[model samples]
Target: MTVALMWEARAVEGRGEELLAWAKARVLEREPERRETFRAPQDRVLVITWWDAEYDAKLPELPEPGDELVTRTVHRWRFEAA
Candidate 1:
């Protein structure tokens, strides 16, 4: 099975660049099959990692960034390939 994990965060006003840099620098304990990062107009950063594992299997994920870096708590989601 294939599982994809999504991590999204909204940066504090005017801190998008810093937040993007921070997200790009994070390294997972185990490398995923694939990973991608994206940003939006509202200072939102999104990271998606694809893994070769069952939906409920334990896997490495990006940790939350510092509170000062984000406007609110990070958002996460898990999905299985159809």
Candidate 2:
């Protein structure tokens, strides 16, 4: 099975670039099959990682950034390939 984990966060005002850099620098304990990062107009950053694992299996995920880096809590989701 294949699982995709999505992590999204909104950085503080005018800090989108810094947030994107931070996200890109993060290293998972175990690398995923594939990973990608994206940014939007609202200073939001999105990261998606695809893994070879069962839906309910334990997996490594990006941790929340420091409180000063974001405006609110991060959001995450998981999906299984059809």
Candidate 3:
């Protein structure tokens, strides 16, 4: 089975570009099967990675940025192909 992991965060104020760059640089370092990144209006950045493993398998995730870089806590989700 394959698992998809999604990670998202909102920059504190005017740091959306910084946060997005940081996420892009880190999200794929572990080298998953596939990955993509996105930006939302409210300084939100999202990264989704597809791994060729079971849902229960461990996977590397985008690490948290500096506390001052984000407004709220980062969010993550995992899903297995149905």
Candidate 4:
């Protein structure tokens, strides 16, 4: 089964594009089965990465974008394919 990792960040004010670009660049280094990025109205960026591995397996994760770039702390969630 594939493991799906969800990463989310809410950029401060007008930094949504910057945050999106950062995520895209980073995720590209570790190619996954599937990856998708989304932006919301309130500068929220969401990235979903799907991998063929266990949830407990060690995997590269999105790092925090720091308080200067984001309004709230980054969020990460892991799930196994149903």
Specify the highest-TM-score model's number.
2
Residues 1-82, model 4: lDDT tens digits: 7999899999989998998888777844567898898988998999999999877988778889878889988999999988
**How much lDDT does each candidate structure score?**
0.95, 0.98, 0.90, 0.87
- Per-residue CA lDDT of model 3 for 3-52, tens digit only, reads 99999999988999999989877734479988999999999999999999
Residue-pair clashes per prediction, in order, are: 0, 0, 0, 0
Would you give me the overall lDDT of model 2?
A: 0.98
Relative to the unseen true structure, what is the C-alpha lDDT of residue 6 in candidate 3, on a scale of 0 to 100? 93
Q: Which stretches of candidate 4 lie over 4 Å from their true place?
A: 27-29
| lDDT per residue (tens digit) for residues 36-74 in model 2 | 999999899999999999999999999999999999999
Reference-based TM-score of each model: 0.98, 0.98, 0.93, 0.89
Q: What are the per-residue Cα lDDT tens digits for candidate 1 across 10-57?
A: 999999999999999999999999999999998999999999999999
Best by the lDDT measure: 2
Q: lDDT of model 1 at residue 12?
A: 95
Better of 1 and 2 by lDDT: 2
- Scored by lDDT, model 1 comes in at 0.95
Instruction: Kindly report which residue stretches of model 1 are placed more than 4 angstroms away from their true locations once superposed.
Output: none
Higher lDDT: candidate 3 or 4? 3
Model 2 earns a TM-score of 0.98
Candidate 4 residue pairs that clash? none
Q: Single out the weakest 10-residue window by summed lDDT for candidate 1.
A: 60-69
